[model samples]
Target: MSRKFKKVVEYTFLILLACIFIFPLIWMVASSMKPEANIPVDMGSIQSLLPSIVPSEWFQTYQELFSRFDVFQYIFNSVTYAIVVTLGSIVVNAMAGYAFSKFDFIGKKVLFGLLIALLIVPAETLIITQFTVAHDLGILNTRLAVILPMIANMFFIYLFRNFFKAIPDEIIESVKLDGANYWTIFWKIILPMSKPAIATVGTLSFILSWNDYLWPLMVLTDSEKFPLQVAITNINTTPPVYTNQVMAILTISTIPLIIVYIVAQKYLLQGLGGSGTGIK
Candidate 1:
């Protein structure tokens, strides 16, 4: 095939793939609205998906779910945890990444080398170790138990390290020459220029932290402190299977993250290729 023809085919294939991925999301919304029988169908009940089409008890289902459990509180807890983790991880990882990318010091290379190695270790492998620490700290049921472990991400630091390293040394030198110190260069110059990379790490961290069930489940025993993901899990029961309720809870759980990505999409996109701007 000609180069232009191949490029067109590639883009066409990608669009189809995108539709394939997005179809499930569309179907989820559709399934959430349908009467119970319609859910098991391939396309779902078509009428329920229409915004104006209302099931008789449509509003009541949402109200019933919320009233039965403090779903709002769960949503709040999840949002709070996700936000705190995102900000903390971003700060710690960005600083670590900047240092690893810029500074030369004793053990720097070794430490970074070890960090990279740690990324290969599955988080599940350290559950016992983490549990022990949580037990010793007496914070097993607290939000802190879930929050503290994930702050300094090895992968994010490494990502920023590589991205920051691509920044020209002359920018740092120029900042230094202007009587600005290391902190100033990092805060004022480097960070603003690295929005895309920062957003990349932040977005991933938020998604993982928000959707996380096993780690949070292990740590938080209190229902009040449970994130939406945890709360959703609790709603599942064996009989009469409230599938609509389950999907409603899931749909609620998914909304804020969707809004976040929609809002931050530009920055997220920029972050992937990283930036090539002069920091100074």
Candidate 2:
């Protein structure tokens, strides 16, 4: 085949793959717009996509969601958890990463190895232990129960360590010559240069905190204190599972994440690229 033909074929394949990935989201938005009775009944056919055929309940689903749940409170809870966890993760992970990268301590390698080993252990394995600990601490059913366990993410630590490791030793040495401490160097120099990694970790942390359901469900029994995802699920499981309402909840819940990714896309890409390439 000609070069142009080969390029066209490659582009076609990629578009098809993208469509496969994106179809569920499209279907979700479409279902949210559909009438409540028609959602599940609509078959696996393109007829659902026809704007004319699917009666647009543009505001009805949203209205129902608002009336049924304390949407703003749930959103506030989600935002509060996400922000707190993200900020805490950044500090803990960055400091740990910086130590691993720059400091020459006994067992540094061993400790890092242990951290890497933790990646293989599924989070589900620790849920029971975590719950017991929370109960012992008298923090269960509080927001602290949700935030405490997730504050130190291994992946973010690895990312920050790698990024910091790439920084020249000369930078630290020069700062030390000015009688600056490690903390000063980190605060003044290292952090300013680590925005990409910060953004990457912050975005991931926010998403994890925001979408979390099971752990929060296990801990928080009060509807007033539930995060958005848990609240949405609770609202979803009423006498009748209103399909449109569920879809609407999903769509609305997804919007903030989408906006965050769009805003942080550039930094995320930079962070991943830098981490992969060893942070030139």
| lDDT of every predicted structure (CA atoms) | 0.79, 0.82
User: Model 2 — TM-score against the truth?
Assistant: 0.83
The parts of candidate 1 lying over 4 Å away from their true place are 1-27, 34-56, 238-241, 261-280
Model 1: per-residue Cα lDDT at residue 204: 74
**Global CA lDDT computed for model 2:** 0.82
- The digit string of per-residue lDDT tens for model 1 on 75-170 reads 889989999999999989999999988999899978878887987777777898989999999999989988988788787887888889989999
Judged by whole-model lDDT over C-alpha atoms, candidate 1 comes out at 0.79
Whose TM-score is greatest here? 2
Q: Candidate 2 — which residues are off by over 4 angstroms?
A: 1-20, 38-47, 50-56, 266-280
Across residues 1-280, which tens digit of lDDT does each residue of candidate 2 receive?
A: 6999999999999999998998888878877776776665675778455322635466677888788878888888999999999899899999999999899999988988999999667777688988898899999899899898878878888899999999999988988999999899988999998888888888878877887778999999888888888977787787677877787888888999899879877766644532233321
- How high is each candidate's TM-score? 0.79, 0.83
Alpha carbon RMSD to native, model 1: 6.5
Each prediction's RMSD to truth: 6.5, 4.8
Least accurate stretch of 10 residues (summed lDDT) in model 2?
Answer: 271-280
Residue 167 CA displacement from its true place in model 1, Å: 2.1
Count clashes in each candidate, considering only residues at least 3 apart in sequence or on different chains: 1, 0
Instruction: Give model 1's TM-score versus the native structure.
Output: 0.79
